[model samples]
Target chain A: MKNRLRLLAYPYILWMALFVVAPIVIVVIYAFGSAGGGFTFDNFSRMGTYLPVFIRSFKLAFEATVFCILLGYPLAYILSKESSRSQGILVLLVLLPMWMNFLLRTYAWMSLLENTGLINKLLTLIGLSPVKMINTPGAIILGMVYNYLPFMVLPIYSVISKLDYSLIEAAQDLGASSAGVFRRVIFPLSLPGVLSGITMVFVPSVSTFVISQLLGGGKYMLLGDLIELEFLGSAYNPYLGSAVALVMMIVVIIMLLIMNRFGEGEEQAVMI
Target chain B: MRDKKSRVPGRIFLALIYIFLYAPIIVLLIFSFNSTNSRTVWSGFSLRWYEKLFNDDMVINALYTTISVSILAAIIATVFGTFAAIGIFNLRRRWQSPVLTLNNIPLMNADIVTGVSLCLLFVASGTILGFGLGFITLLLAHISFNVPYVILSVMPKLKQLDNNLVDAAQDLGCTWLQAFFKVVVPEIKPGIVNGALIAFTMSIDDFIISYFTAGSGTQTLSMVIFSMTRKRVTPEINAVSSLMFVFVLILLIIINIRSSVQDKKLRAKPA
Candidate 1:
């Protein structure tokens, strides 16, 4: 009976083997293969030429992650303090924008950030010089933070809300101030959520092509843009794209592993 | 007094963040009503863009493709995922862990890598299958990413099940298939439903994966928006988005109500 029940999974297993696992295996083979159709280290060896793109991608992703934590932690903490009904509605609102088409959300900013855009129009109205807001590194990072902020907020908010209120009361009863109670009790207990939140924000921000493409104005080339160019754009180098993608896969995996180590087996609140 | 003061700042902070988040969407929504074709200019209040959006064949085709793909992918993923979740649940601890790790690959990896990998797979297979990237590949890739969410959703419900329930069903003269279908499946229906909703949402919102796998022949709604963004965008996109925003809002509200009602039913079930 049990075997028959397990037999039900055979179709799914077959599907994942074809669609998920086999694709990665293909990426590996392509990553190492030469254009002439033999094994070669040329792809890895030429990676140094694109080091600046790698650095910029990581640097921007890092700054975005930091900003998400700074902005989102407070937001999550405050959100958790709300009544349960309000918390549900607020959480939904926080997540609703992300459900909208990603490209539309990014394009909305494009109009606002253009040189003759609304932001500039408002600036000129105040007798201030127009700032070049669009197509800058700052704009790209802003895009990342705005899109991924909910990821940071949701996990930490879940963790903090689940923390034992008795611990906070216990600390206060022992003469710990409110700040001390939060710092020692609430914050430490919520580290797992924070760590996972960091991973969530950092991974997507690092790998986004459209955000950089639309906001960075073809001036700033991140690894995502580089990889996309190698694959779909004029460059048309699948081997090089595979190599970059492999490295990206490795970096994301390593970061997630580090996060999981600190997250202490709290289930990833991925459903939202 | 300190508590009240802190509360005031907390409300302010929430207000500011809400403003930050909604500003772009508000801007987009307002411009959809602008009379002129220019994205920045507002000649007068009009629905010209919205009218244009519905008439454009490209927009209509892409919208059709987007909806069909999302629905098909979500339904298929939910079916496969629910079965797999049960199978994994019943597996030995050692085997289950490894399967779960493989499952997380899609969830954890960057969208670009997943899309590229799948693109490579399809291109390579095209040599034998005689099919390159298009609607088929796009649907397949979406199903791939979406299945993991379904699996993750169903796993928790499986964990919640009483271990001996199936056995009890069998002892009550039910056959193995009957026990499985009539007893086990109904228990995890909520999880299955939740997974489908998540899968649908993810499929609808996905851009990066769809961008890579969609190839040149076909375009999803986001792909159309992307092409527009690359050049000077028309106000027609704004109209499409406003309609989409309302459509999705209504869709989500309906789904939420259905699920909450189901949840209430589950609670009312006698222990």
Candidate 2:
């Protein structure tokens, strides 16, 4: 019976090898070899030309991650302070939008941010000048923040709520002001959650093609858009696409490593 | 007085954040009822788009594909992932971490990279065999991506499980399989359900991977919605979005209520 139970894993192992392991192996091979089947360094050489794109992707993703932290930290803190019943409902509210189709949510932003859309119309009604919100990097950043804010909030909220309240009371009794208590005690204690939130927001934002495509109006291309274009666009080159994907995989792995370093000796509090 | 004053700002901040989070969904829902196609102008309330949405062949086909793919992928991933979790749990302690890390690779990798890599695999396989990209490849990709989430959710529950219960059941003249089904399965049922739910949502919400692997002929709702963005999307798309939102909201509310009731029952009973 034990042997049979062990045998239950064989099919799953086979499936993982074929679908998960083999696909990534193929990407590495394609990244190294050319379409003509000869080994070449041309793919890596060609990636140098797109260095600016990589920089821009990382920059925008970093900006978006910062915004998510700023906005989400306060909300999470407030939620964690609430009664348990209210906290459950508020957390559900945060998660509700996430369950909606992300493309649809991003598309909704298109209507709200367009020049003649809802925000601009409201601005005109109130005698304010309409700002060009769509088709810009700022708009893409907004979309990223909107879509990923819950991911940022949930982890921090989980960590903050689990914090020992006695520590805060102890600090206050020691004549530490509330601000100092938060900065010195709360923030440091929540570093694991904050670091995980940054990784969660940054990794997806850097690699997102759809959010940029919908909000950036194709004028601003991130690394994800570049990789998609190579595979599915008119510039269909699998080798080049694989090389770009390999680079992205490396960057994401590095982010995961950073997250793991901070999350060390914890119970992996990060969840999507 | 100071505590009350501090509470007001916290309340206001939460209200504003809720507004920010919900504004787009509210606009989408409202637009779904507009008579005219213009998103900003609410000329009058009408269900014309909702009516049209039912007859739109492309939208219906994409919905069919999305539902079938997600359901099939979720079920398969749950079964395999549950057994795989059990197998990993029973392994010698040293081997578990490496195998679990292998499981985490799909969960950790970016969606675009996974999509591109899988596309490369399928395209290569197509050249070797005479098959082309279609529903099968899309289903396979969805299942592959979903299994890791299932494993993650189930592994935690497996760890929390008391293995001695299963041993007790087996010693009571039950076979190993019977002990598993009667004792272990019941204990880990919540995790299995949670894993399946995650799998279903991930499969439905996927776009980048589905876009690459689905090819031109077969499209999920996400792929269709993506293509619709290239043109001036009709309000029918908004109608579909609103319906999907309502469906998911209802499903979530039911789950929340059921779980809360269970929580109450658990609390009411003595530990």
Candidate 3:
């Protein structure tokens, strides 16, 4: 009976092998195989042209991750302290915007950050000159931060809310300062959530083609845009695109591994 | 009074975060009703754009396709994934861990990579299958990405199942399959439902993967909006977006309320 039950998983296993595992092999095949249909490192060799793009994508993603940490950590911390009823409501509010179609959320910013957007209109009405907010790296970073902040907050909040209140009480009774209690006990305990949050925010921010295009106005070419350009956009080169994607996959895996090694106790915090 | 006074900063900080999160959505909502053709300049509010969205064949077709694909993908993935989770749960630890790791690929990989890789797979398979990328491939891609989430959601519930429950049903003279249906299905129904819900939510909101696998022959709502966005301004998209926002908002609210009520009942139960 047990064997028969385990046999039920075989069909799904076959499905995943075809859909999930095979495609990754194909990505590698295309990445390494040259246009002439022979194995070559030419695709990777050609990545020099996109060196600036790689740098800018990582730089911007890093900046956005930092911003999310600064903005989200406090929000999650405070949210952890709220009454459970209000906590549910507030957490929903944080997540509701994310459930809006990804494009719609970015498109929301397109209207807000444009030269004649609502923000600019507000500025002008107040007798201030309109600022050029759209089609810049800053706009792209802002878009990344805006879209992924909830990814950061939700993990941290889940971790912190479940923290042992008795630990804090013990620290306070032992004469630790409130700041020291938070710094030593709370922050250290919440590191898993923080680490997972960094992974969640950074990966998407780095790999986002839409946020850069819609917000950066095609002026800046990040790794995502570069990959898109090869596959679906103006440039029709999947080999080079595969190379870029492979590089990104490796980088992301390495980052996640390092972080996982540090504190992934609540790594499942991300599924929330 | 002093304690409340000291709490003002955290409250203000949270308020500002909320504003940052909502300001863009509010802008999109406000523009959806703009009377003038322009998205930037707001005249008196009008329902013209919403009316236009209703009349627009492109938007309507995309919406139809989007809903169809999401529903199909969610249901199919949930069925396959629930069985897969049960199977994995019963497997030896050695094989189970490897399969679980494989399951994380779709969730962990960047959407673009997943999209591009799947696009390649469909194109390659189409050569032998005599079909190219289209609605079928699009639906297939949605199901593929959604299955991992379903498996993840259901596995926990399967683990929570009582060890003696299945045996108890079998000893009562039910066939193994009958025992599973009679005993196990009811136990894991919540998980199956949760998996389906997550699958649906992920599918409906998906763009990047769908954008690639969908091909030129088909379009999801995300693809349509993306095309509209290429232009400087398209007020119809704003109207459609506002509607989507409200629809999801309502759906989420209902789910949230139901879950909270369930939580209350669970808590109220005597231990």
Candidate 4:
């Protein structure tokens, strides 16, 4: 039986090994090699060239994450507080657009933010100056929020929905004010969801290409765009792109590990 | 707290969010019928864009390509993923979590990084072997990206299965494969269906991976939309998007309805 099970496990394990494990291993190996020569530390040595790109990507990702948290938390709280029937409707509303294509949705943002689009027209009608919302950092941030807000809300909603209401009442009955009740009772309980949501939003937004390409325009040089330009553009340098990709993987792995540890700790705390 | 004033802001926020999400869709639908090439102005509604969309041979080719790729990828990924999930269930406890995590890593990795890395790998392979990129590259990329999602979706159902049925089937002299086919599959068939649905959607909706992997003639629907929007916003693109949205909405509703009906029948079965 055990031998049969082991045989059954072969195809799955091999599939993952070839696709997930092999591609990343290839990246790490290329990251250590010189572009056109023997093995060297040249890739790592030139890290200074890419440090600003990392910083900019990290900053934009951080800002987008913060926006997701702020917008997603209240929406989650409201959904959690509602009756399950209405909550179902709310969840559907959030997920419907999510099921559509990501590129399509980003294109939708382009239409909405265009100078002659609806928002600008509305602004003109109200006698306000037309603001160039498209192709700005603000547009990138808005696009991030629009794409990822559902991801943030769902996890937090799962956490908040399962929260014990009696805990809030207990705090209130002990003369805790509204803010105190929230801080002491609600926030701590929902930290797992918050952490997971932030990780989800941050990791993807950090390396998203289509959004930055369509909405951010070529004006901005995100890490994703840089990697694309090197790997796929006129510069056809796979070695450099591989190095950048490896660095991104390492950073994201670190973040995910941190989030996992935090989540585990929070779970233990909740159990206690 | 349940009173009117407390609910007011929440109601407004919900409304605003709905508007934010759906307004683009509404505009896309409206503009699809506008006679003007520029989508913003009101030049009277007509079916001209729809007519043009049908006549465009490139659009038709892209639609065919996108549908074929998604369907093929969905089937292969679902089969591989389901087998993998079952195999993982039978694995030693110590190795299971890590293996699962390894599989999930693909799901979490950024699309751009994955696309670039895969493109490089294919380029290297093609250079070494003297082959050109085409449908095979596209399929492999789709399968790699989709298998993880399928595993994640179906694993939970596999975990919930009762072990006794398989044991009983084995005791009745059924072969292992027979037992698995007769006992295990039917129990978790819903998971397989759900996993396949998700894979289909993800494969169809993917932009970055397809962009990287597709050849000049193998453009998908999303690639067409991307190129069109870059050139200029046209009512034809809007017509396509609105149609795509409605198609997805209908699919979602049908899936939900089918599952609910199945649930009802399951509940009526003998305990």
Candidate 5:
């Protein structure tokens, strides 16, 4: 049986070799090699060009992560406390938007935030001045929260659902206040889920050009935009694009390492 | 006693969050049927936009491409991912985690990066293959991204399974192939199905990857919708968006039903 199964695996081995393994191999090689002439340090040396973009993308990602955690924690707690049937419905609600196309979800925000859109229409009807919600940092942040909130909510919910309520009760019996119980028990127990969600949101938000480009209207240049410009825009510079990609990868690795450090103590709490 | 007032505020907070989450989608569905072109005022609801959506040839082509790519990607991902999951399980226990993580790289990496890199690969290959980027390249890209999800889903089930069952089947004089098909396949079927469902969703919902890899002729529904919204905030898009919203909603319901039934059956089984 094992031998037969091993034989069946060859097709998948070939598939991964051609697809997942090969494309990444090409990128890693090209990241080191030069663009036109030959292998050189030219692309690596031009890292200075992407410095501002790295900062901007990282800062925005940081802001989005913070917001997701803040909003998501309490919501997840409530969801975990709900009955199983209601929890299923709540999960479906959170995941439904995720099933819709990313671009569609982004456009939904566009409809909401456009000058003549629903929000402004409502504000004007209410006798308040219409606010410019599109093409701004705030709009981009709103889009980020809308699109990425599920990542935060799902992991935290998973952890909270699996939490042993008896531990909380025990803490309460020991005369711990509600806040104290949360801080000492629930919070620490849920940190792994929090880490996973944070990583999920942060990585995408930092590298996401679509939200910043569509919502911020190209006024805000994030790292992904910079990479896109080099590769596809008028510049058409693959070398510089590859360099920027490498830098982005490094930044993500650093972010993950930080998360890993903080997550070490919390790994015991992983619910999934 | 103090928790009662606190719980009221918590309930209100939950209500507000639900309102935030669902309001945009509700607005989208409502405006899709608005009779007037303007969104500010709602005239009597009509189906004009839905009619227009059917007549748009370009939109039709995009939907065709999207469905085609998603199906092909789902099939390929399920088959390959199931095989890979089984293969990794047959290996020594210690090697599994790293192998699993390696397979997950394509998932964890940013979609835009994957899109760009796949574009580069296609661009490079088109030179050798003498075929410009189109359906084939798009399928390849979708398969690459979808496979990781399949693996992630299937591996856990394979890990939980007992290996001795397969060995015992072989001891009973069944051929290795027979044992694999009759024993191993049934054990992991749920995981494989779940993986395929996720792959289907991911393949259909993906915009960034599809945007880069798909040529003009192979543009998916999302690409068309994206371009349309960029140009004009038309109600036809809303109509199509609402349709899509309903389609996914139904899919979610079906998945829930299947899962609950499976849960019941599993609980009924003796451990």
Candidate 6:
């Protein structure tokens, strides 16, 4: 029975090796190997030219992550304080938009942000000047925050809801001010969720092509857009695409390591 | 009085956030019922887009592909992941962490990276052994990405399970297969179901990976919607989005009700 049970994992192991491990290995080889199949370092060196794109990607992703934290934390805190039934319903409400196709959601934003769109129409009706919202970096950041805010909220909400209210009460009883109690007790306790949320938002935001493509109107080029262009656009080069992907993977892995450190080996709870 | 004042601000803040989160979806839903195709103008209420959606072969094909691929990927990943979790749970402590870390790589890695890497692999292999990229490669990519989520979801349940029950069942003259089928499977059924649900959602929501892996001829709903948006925004796509939103919303409501009932029953039991 033990042997049979052990044998059950063989298929999974084989599949992982062939599909997961081998593809990554291929990516590495393509990143380092020349088009003629000889080893070369040109791909890595060529990445230097696209330094601006990389910086912009990280900057936009960082800004988006900050916005998500600011907006999501309060909502998550309030939801955590709700009755369990309302908590369930409110969390579902937050997550329901995510169930709709992300492209559609972004498209909806595109329409609203356009010059003659609904928002501008509303602004005109109210005697306010219409602001240029589309085809800008701010628009891309808005799309990122809109699409990935749920990722930030769910983890933080899970952590905050699981927190023991007694700790806050204890801190207050010890003559701590309300702000001090939150700073010393609640904020410190929720760091793991915050870290996870940051990674959850930043990683996808940095690596997204679709959001920038739809919202940025092709005027703004992020790292994702650059890598995608290399593979599928006019300057189609798989080797360079692999190199860019390799670099993005390294950055994401570093973020994951930081997340794991803050998570302290119990990261599964934040999956909600 | 102060508590009430503070609570009002928090409630208002939450309301504003909900509005922010839902504004796009509400806009999409309204447009889905609009008579005119223009997004800015309301030409009266009509279900013309929904009617057009049903008649569109391309949209129907993409929908079919998306649903089938997600279901297939979810089932296959769940089976493999359940067994893998069991096997890893039974392994020596030293080996378990390394195996789990490997499992987390795909989950932690960016989708664009995974998609590109898989695309390279398929292209590389095609040159060497004539393997091609299309629906099969897309399905494989989905399954590979989904397995880790299933493993993560199931491993915790496996840990909480009592080993003694399985041992007792085996002692009652049950074979290994019988014990596993009757005892272990039932014990971890919730985790298995949860894992499948997560896998299904992940597979269905996936776009970047499917975009790269799906060669020119194949398209998932996401890929179709993406291309449609790139060319021109169509009301038919809005109709499809509305249907998908309602479908998932209904599914989630059912799941929530069932779980709350289970929670009530568990609470009613004596400790």
Model 6, B1-271: lDDT tens digits are 1456668888889889888888878888888999999887889999999999998899999999999999999999999899998887777677678778888878877888888888888887777988788889888899999999998989999889898988999899888789889999998988999999999999888999998998888899999999899996877778988899889988888988998898899899966
True contacts kept of 2: 0.68
TM-score of each: 0.95, 0.95, 0.96, 0.94, 0.93, 0.95
- Model 2, residue B235: what's the lDDT? 77
Better of 4 and 6 by lDDT: 6
User: What is candidate 3's CAPRI-style docking category based on DockQ?
Assistant: high
| DockQ for candidate 5 | 0.58
Poorest 10 consecutive residues by lDDT, candidate 4 chain B: B115-124
Question: What are the root-mean-square deviations of the candidates from the true structure over C-alphas?
Answer: 3.3, 3.0, 3.0, 2.2, 2.8, 3.2
- Per-prediction DockQ comes to 0.74, 0.73, 0.83, 0.67, 0.58, 0.68
Q: Write the per-residue lDDT of candidate 5 for residues A17-73, one digit (tens) a residue.
A: 676667666676677777566777877888887678788888888888899999899
* Top candidate when judged by lDDT against the true structure: 3
| lDDT for each candidate structure | 0.89, 0.89, 0.90, 0.84, 0.83, 0.87
Task: Give residue A161's lDDT in candidate 6 (0 to 100).
Answer: 95
- Model 1 is docked with a DockQ of 0.74
lDDT of 6 by residue, A145-237 (tens): 999999999999999999998988898899999889877788778878888898889989999999899999988898889888988788888
What digit string (tens of lDDT, one per residue) describes model 3 on residues A1-272? 67877987888889989999999999999999866799999999998988999999999999999999999999999999887879888898898888899898998888788887888999999999999999999999999999999999999999999999999899999999989999878988888888879988998899999999999999999999999999998889999999999998898889789778756544444324
Candidate 1 chain B: 10-residue stretch with minimal lDDT: B1-10
- Which whole-number lDDT from 0 to 100 does residue A222 have in model 2? 93
Interface RMSD of each: 1.1, 1.2, 0.9, 1.5, 1.8, 1.4
lDDT (Cα, 0-100) at B86 in candidate 1:
86
Model 2, span B1-271: residue lDDT tens: 1467779989999999999989999999999999999888899999999999888899899999999999999999999899988887776677678777788778767888888888888988998998889999999999998988888898889889887888899899898779989998989999999999999999989888899999889999988888888886877778888999999989898988899899899899996
lDDT of 1 by residue, A95-182 (tens): 9998889888888888889999999999999999999999999999999999999999999999999988898889899999988988
Fnat for candidate 1 (0 to 1): 0.74
Q: Summarize candidate 4's per-residue lDDT along B73-137 as a digit string, tens digits.
A: 99999999888887887888898889988987777788877776677677667889986667888
